[model samples]
Target: MEKPRTIPSVFTPQWLPLGSLVLLLVTLALALTGCAAEKKWQYLPATRGEERSIYVIAHGWHAGIALPAEELGDELGFVREYLRPGRYYEFGWGEAEFYQADKITPAIFLKAVFWKNPSVMHVFSMPAEPAQQFPGADMVELKLSATGVKHLKDSLRTSFKLDAAHRPHPLKGGAHGEYRFFTAQGYYLITHTCNTWTAKVLASGGVPMDTVFTLRSGGVMRQAKDARKEYLKLRPDRAEQEGMQ
Candidate 1:
């Protein structure tokens, strides 16, 4: 009698083959890139009366730091003498042409996305609070300690391309007189975008940031909110006990 042949089970586990592994990696890469493309904002301590606040603001697809104009100018040294008396100063880093362009064109978009252009740092002196300065904009406010302020100042200092005299290399044209442009330290690319620059500043300021894989503003803001919440939870009396020194 002939013995019956049995069919192999289809549910058996198979090794993650090379093709599958590669596909997984590619998927993860794409997902990460997409996430990075979105805008984000965040801040520490939280807004309070009279105490200075550092605001991370989102202007459409762009991100920037809205700092107290006086403190920033004083601490940064580079901008100290240049900054006019203002309530706040907004700083943004991006491709020169794209940043200054009246509107985004195909050429500007292509160059900015592909990292085919040099970068610029835009400094806007505001006579009002950031929210008042840029109405209808998205913002995250953080109340930082003196140490945090120093970290932010140091970070801003390094982001500039200064001359031998330690002055920023200014661009001739900008949004306006109060709004000036300077040479930036790095090239702008999809991987290292404006939001990514903001994230670096926040991380340098001692605000916890997942800098390694964070390429989006949303990511930075998310981490900032989480950190802020955790801090407040740990010290429920933070507001009452600590002064904004």
Candidate 2:
């Protein structure tokens, strides 16, 4: 019988297919690299004019003051009788309340005012809560002016004195210190307190630390869709860092 013919080995002609496989991988890698290098939007800092406009829009009257209920009644003729004392001790008046607080006194009444043109508008007082009991409240006024708000913002950028970041500290009478800035309608409000817990809440909520600051800072008479765009631009790098975390 004739000897069986021998078959060639599978590896004998491997380079042709191997070369094609390698080329495919290299092409794929280049495509992926191009995708990775795609362009992304860059954040631009707000210009002076833009900053001024933002300040104006954010400065409207949205102020609040906490005062003894009785004292509020004495000062404002009509107390916010509808409010429940313990349940709703918070108050909101005008933009002036955005910044200034002379001192902290328990049982003190807070009076807040707002004005686009101070002469044209009626000054408003903080409303009362039903559950609160201010037997012998004193009056405390929180004032905000355009110049003052700008000064406060500048102070924040330069010095840490304003407590705008909501840092916590202890006070003499078992109280905690905190502050916040907030805006509503076409107004801004600032609030200060020895109550540390309250401060944290306000700061986390992005509220103004002082109503006076809010009024001086300025704001748009009407809300804008891109109002928060600057704030986002302020920390563009944060998103990438957060994603890595």
Candidate 3:
């Protein structure tokens, strides 16, 4: 019989096999953990001369949809009652703990990160005057048509939990100034984060967003900025160019 073929010395070394196994596990772990990089919010280069426009505003650590309440309410009846004679509204979704908690603690953070925490949609009515400037809030105007608005309204309607009457379930004693909280339809988790939800909503409204990479507010704002740039390029004009600055 032919002599038994001996394995290569490199593979036969005592530590070589163990080292290879460890290397494989390390590489797998790194691959699994690698995720999209985080970024800071920035203003979009675009104009605000569009007949009617919507905005996605990035708060310090959160993101919200800002739009004409009248138009949105017209499409989603639940919001009609809360439109409150205001022309615009900013809606934000977040984990109930971070949203409703008067004080933050370790437990709340843990629950928000890992637990299936209840979510809340906060509505803030915006009126025209000295334009309310939310500190550190970066706003991006979205270029959308009437049809796109309808789709956005539909997406917003689905984000809330409806009552028997198909209206948003308003949280009692939740109203604060022009803001209030409502029962949201989804649960908050690491993967289904607030920013991720915002991305999904924007996509439904015909805005081009990379939902997969948008796990943070920065990612959402970055995509919005890119879309705004493209929009301005397509509709260049003197007034629009001024707004781009």
Q: Model 2 reaches what TM-score against the true structure?
A: 0.17
The residue-by-residue lDDT of candidate 3 on 40-59, one tens digit each, is: 22233244443357888876
lDDT (Cα, tens digit) per residue for candidate 2, span 144-191: 223332443332222111145433221111011112222222332122
Stronger candidate by lDDT (1 vs 2): 1
Worst 10 residues of 3 by lDDT: 4-13
TM-scores for every candidate against the unseen true structure = 0.72, 0.17, 0.72
Top lDDT model: 3
Q: Per-prediction RMSD in angstroms?
A: 17.4, 30.1, 17.8
Candidate number with the higher lDDT (2 or 3): 3
Per-residue lDDT of 38-132 in model 1, one digit per residue for the tens?
32333343434423568887664566787876677555656644555566777778777777665555555557665557888877767777766
Candidate 1 ranges with C-alpha deviation above 4 Å? 1-30, 33-52, 73-75, 80-83, 172-176, 239-245
lDDT of each candidate versus the true structure: 0.63, 0.25, 0.64
Error of 3 at 241 (Å): 3.7
Show model 2 residue runs off by greater than 4 Å.
1-150, 153-227, 241-245
